[model samples]
Each structure stands twice: as structure tokens, then as C-alpha cells.
Target: MRKVFITGTDTGVGKTLISSLLVKKFNAYYFKPIQTGSKEERDVNIVKNLTGLNGEYFLPEVYLLKEPLSPHLAAKRENKKIELKKIFCPQKEPLVVEGAGGVFVPLNENSFMLDLMQKFSLPVLVVARSTLGTINHTLLTLEALRQKKIDILGVILNGPLNLENKNAIEYYGKVKVLAEIPKLKTINSMGIEELLTNFNI
Candidate 1:
């Protein structure tokens, strides 16, 4: 199966927005491996609403925890343990898997978001905020992926355009800046279209 694992430098850096855009553009299946706080918010629903895709294109999460904390903590609160074996990609092509929070986020005591991506053996598309603190966050993220010897597709700079941050990330991290998305006041198709104009999927 063909897949692209979407991760961010930090939580709320717009991973979902990029994932949703890719899903909409490719009409690909979306999967969130370990989802916490499903009761409060669901990434699947967000993708559905954003992409306007049918339910079949969105897969149910492997682990669904109640609390909004990290997967490890959230699973502990529910008295459940996450097994990496339980997290498997669908036997289908053109799937876009969205990771929970940043790359180092814990899926269990030993496993992290990076481990999951490694297991999938797919190219990673990192979403980074184009604001302050992004240089360290993004470069560190790139370094982590490099240490693991994983394939990096590219980085997507989200939010307002910052040339310095963009150039620095590309040069220092030795990774291409695939795209940049403008800060959105809305998230409908038209707004998404404008934000995506900087680059294509």
C-alpha cells in the first residue's frame, strides 16, 4: 500500500490541515493510529468535514483513549495498554496516516510516533509552523528522522509566510520546503484552495 505519514513539529502545528488537504486532493484514505480524547475531538471527523469525503475513505483508529493527554498517559487512565502490533496500516493504496502530535510523542512506554512511522516504512511529510521557535523545533525534528534513517518526503510550512524561517529550515535541516500555507480565517474548500496555491500535492 502507498502511504504518507503526516507529523508536525509540535501539537497544533496544523498536521490535520495538511493531512486533510492531501486527502482531499488525492481522495486518499485517512487513518489516525492512536487517538486520544475521541469524546472531545476526533481527527477522523475533522478530516471528513474538511475533505467532504465519504466514510469509507476514513478508517477507524487503532487505539481510542478517552483523555486528551499523551497516548501513554491517556491509555493508562483507561487501564489499557497499546501494542504496536495492533497498529497496522490498511491493505490499501494511497493512504495518508496522520500521527498524534509531534514525532516523539509516546504511543506506549517504549514506542513513539517515530517508531510507528518506521514500522510503516513510508515517507514522512512534516508540517511545521512558520513562526518563532520553528527553526529549533523543525531542525530537531529533521535530525530525529535522519537519525532513524527514515525517508523524508519534505516539510510543509504552515501559517503566515516567514522567509527567514523557511530558508533556515531548508538550509540547516537539508530538507526541501515542499509548501507553505497561509493562516486561514476559514477552512472551507475555497479557503483551502487558496492556501494550497503555493504548492501542489
Candidate 2:
């Protein structure tokens, strides 16, 4: 088993859902270092509820900003700042960690999500949309990770299966199409288990 950092081509790209899948697949702990958004929509809670996992399987977020904005602006709104030094992984192995938005999302004035990804140095699994515009977004994300010399586990396509987009991403991005998760009528542990059988990490 290997620890993985989950990032997305953009916000609302189903990172949390994929994170829950990985956590369930590996029986691993889930950690979201910095979370921005209202308390009601916390990623940890969502993962726990979706997977029916307990608190032991989830780690507390370092920064839980109330505003649903970019991390830097959200922290500023609350009169605080995000520091990379304060974020660290628990001793648990094969943990699944997720990022806020895209790779370039700002964490602070000087540091972006890319900086934190580098700090962790975990192999990355990028979650991407399985629709139009994904080619550009997914390719750019892969390229950025490559330039940083980050080890990419590959990309996961979420939504209705689009063969063209999947082939384009695999060919142009030069990365494996690890899995294609369809839009489930009900997103729960059962759904995740079904998807697990469809693809291997």
C-alpha cells in the first residue's frame, strides 16, 4: 500500500468522493490538511458519512476556514494565515490526503497548493472531469506536477464515461487513465464498493 495525495483539475471535480473511494479501498486514514468552506460541508464528515467510517479513519483539518473561497482569501477574511510548517502527516501509513482545489490554488501570499504538495512528496492521483474542457485542465495539471518532479499515480475521470476525453487525456497527458467513475444516483459506501471492482489503483 502507498500513501496518496488527491488533487483535482478544478474545484467541484469530485475529489472528496474519490478520496472516500481510496480510503475505503485501502482501509486507510483520510486527511485534508487545509479545508475552506462552511462547517456543514466539511470533507472529512462527508467522507465519513459516505463510507460509514468512524472518526478514527479521519484526521482533523489544520485550517477550517468558514468562507467558501480560495484558501488565502478565506484565511485573510478570518484574520489568519496558512503556514506550511504547521501541516504534517500523521504516522499512519497508506493514508489518503486530499487538496483544496487545483494545484495552483493559493494557500498564502507566498505559497500555493503546489508548495504543500511538494512538502508532502506523496504520489499524486489527479481527479478530473469526464467531459468537455477537461483535456486542457487535466493536461495542465499533469504538466505542472511533472515540472515539480512529483510522482503522479495517474488520473481518475469522474462523471459520464466519455471515451474521447479519456483517450485524449491518456494520450496527451502521457498518464494512465486509472479509473472512470460514473455519476451515481446514490453516492454511498455501496456505490464506492461497486466502483472499486471496476478499477485497480
Candidate 3:
């Protein structure tokens, strides 16, 4: 089965949004290794509402820390450690694995989100903002993935429509801008479907 690990240049950059769209398009299983803002099931709930995809599959971490902080710090505050092995139990379908925060965000003392990506041995789909400063962030993220020898499926640029950065990303970054999603005041399943079609998901 084909699997793609979805991550972002930073938090709130639309990793979840893109992941949900991919899952809906490909009818793939979804997994969130470590979530910190809400209950583990809450991530699945939001994705379900956003994608309108039904299945008996959705896996999140067992320790759902309430703090909206990095996983490592949240786990520390809760007096727990995130076991890497827990993130990689075998699944039966094609998967879209969502990562928390940026590539280097710590999940524990020695492991970061990228480490989890490595653990899964899945190609990455980077979700980035379409606004200012995205070029630097996107390039750096791509470089990091290159350093790790991770296969990058490409990047999805999210936010208000902006052609300048889009061209710059395509030209300078030397990576395909797989899709560009317009800023949405509210999101629905059809909207998600539109974005997926753009990406050929």
C-alpha cells in the first residue's frame, strides 16, 4: 500500500487539512502519532467531519495531553514518555500519517517528528503556507528531508491565493508545488474534494 507522511514547515500550517483531503481522495487510513492540543480521538473527529470519510480506522496516541504544546514538553509535564514503537503498529491499508509541528519538533529527548517519519519509511508530503517567508521555510524543510534520504512526494501550498510565492517556490525551490489552496473562511467536504482534485489526489 502507498503511504505518505504529512508534515508542515511549522504548526498551524495546514498539515491536518491536507492530510484529511488526501485520505478522502485516496480512501486511505489516517494516523496521528502524537497529538497534544486535545484528546487523541478529537483529531479523528475533526478529520472525519472535514473529510466525511467513514471507516473503522483512525489511530492516535494513547496519552492525549491537553496542553497545546510540543509533544515532548507535553509528555514531560504529564510525566510520560512517548514510545516510538507505539507509533508504528502495522496497519492494513494505505496510510496518511500526520505529524505534529515542524520537522524538528521534539517528541522526546532524542527523537523529533522527522525521526517518526524515518521510522515509518514513508514518503513525505510537506504542507506549507503560501504567504511571506514560505520560500525559506519550504527550502529548509526540503533540505532536511534530503539529508535524511526521505522520499518527498512534493509540497502542497496552503492559504490565500498568491502567485508570486507559488512561482518562486516552483522556480527556486526546485520542487513541484503540488497544489495551492485558497484561504477558506469555512471548510466542507466539497471544498476538501476540490483541493484534492487539484493535487490529483
Candidate 4:
């Protein structure tokens, strides 16, 4: 199975958006390792809405946290510890693992999102905004992935408005831009079917 880790340059960079689309495209199982904020605001709901892949696809041990802060701080406030083992369980099909916030976001006092990714041992698919300053963030994220010896399965640049940002990321980062998704687009099953057809997934 083709398991992939989905992370973003920062929060609100559409990691859930791209991850849901990927789950539909590849017909893969979706897993959100750790989700903070309320249950309604979690990415698993969005993924379920988009893919209609049944409850089996969404794997999250701790569903809701009161605060929308980083997982570590939120867990601390709630007197809970983020369990890494629960997040690294095996899935029957290809798994699309979504990370909270950015690559370096803390999950505990000594562990971050990168540490979780390393534990999972999944290839990464970076979802970055297609705007100014994206190049810097993307590059830094790429370097972090490299340092951790994580396999990067290219990038998916969200919000396809800035051609310049896209060009810079491709030129400097030297990674394939797998897909450039525009903002405010409705990607249903049909759209996902088309993407799978095109990519021969």
C-alpha cells in the first residue's frame, strides 16, 4: 500500500483539503494522528465528508480538545498525553496521515510533528500555499524532512494563484509539483475520479 504523510508549511495552509482529495484519488484510508481543537473543527470530519469512505477510514484516538492551540500545550492543559503508538498503527489499505499545523509543531515537551512522522515511517506530501514567502517555508520544510531522512513524495501547492511562487518552489526546491489546486474549488467524487484516471491510480 502507498502510505503518505500530509503536512503543511503552516496552519490554514489546506493540509486537510489536499489530504481529503488524495484519499479520494487513491482510494486510501485516512488517518489523523493527533487532532486538537473541537471535534467539529477537526480535519477528519472534512475528510469523511469529502471521501464518504465510511467510519473505518478515520482513525483518531483523541477526538476533541477544548483549545485550538498546539497539541502538546492543549494536552497539558487537559492533563492528557499524546500517545504516539496509537498514531502509528497499521492500516489495511494505503494510509493518508495528516499532521497538525506545521512540521515542527509540538505534540509533547520533547516531541514534534516531525518526530511522529519519523515514527510512522511514511513518505511525505507537503501541502503549501501558493503565495509569497511560500518558497522560504517550503524550503525549510524540505530541509527538515531531509534532515530526518524522510522520503518526500513531492509537493502539492494549494491556491494556484501565484505562478511566481509555484515557479520558485519548483526551481529552487527541485521537487515535482504533483498538483496545484486552486482555492474555493469543489472537489467531489467525480473530480477525484478524474484525477485518478489522469494519474492512473
Task: Pick the TM-score winner.
Answer: 2
Residue-wise C-alpha lDDT for candidate 3, range 1-201, written one tens digit per residue: 378889899998988888888778778788886889784345767788887777565765555777889999989988999878776734657888888889999989899988888888888989999999999999889989888989888888989888998888888778888888778777877778777666564
RMSD in Å for all candidates: 1.4, 1.1, 2.0, 2.5
Task: Provide TM-scores for the models.
Answer: 0.96, 0.96, 0.91, 0.88
Report model 4's TM-score to 2 decimal places: 0.88
Model 4 lDDT tens row, 31-74 = 78677886347678877887888898777644357688999998
lDDT of 3 at 109: 87
User: Predictions ranked by lDDT, top down?
Assistant: 2, 1, 3, 4
- Prediction-by-prediction clash tally: 0, 0, 0, 0
lDDT of 3: 0.82
> Where is the poorest 10-residue window by lDDT in model 1?
192-201
Q: Best-fitting candidate, measured by lDDT?
A: 2
lDDT of 1 by residue, 1-201 (tens): 268999999999999999988988888999998899888999899889887889999899889888999999999999999888888988867999999999899978899989988998889999999999999999999999989988999999999989999999999999999888888898777766665565676
Task: Name every residue pair that clashes in candidate 4.
Answer: none
What local lDDT does model 4 show for residue 123?
89
Report, for every candidate in turn, its global Cα lDDT versus the true structure: 0.89, 0.92, 0.82, 0.81
| Candidate 1 lDDT for residue 118 | 90
By summed lDDT, the worst window of 10 consecutive residues in model 4 runs over 192-201
List pairs with backbone clashes in candidate 2: none
Point out where model 3 deviates above 4 Å. Answer: 39-41, 194-199
The parts of candidate 4 lying over 4 Å away from their true place are 185-201
As for model 4, its CA RMSD to the true structure in angstroms is 2.5
- Arrange candidates by TM-score, descending: 2, 1, 3, 4
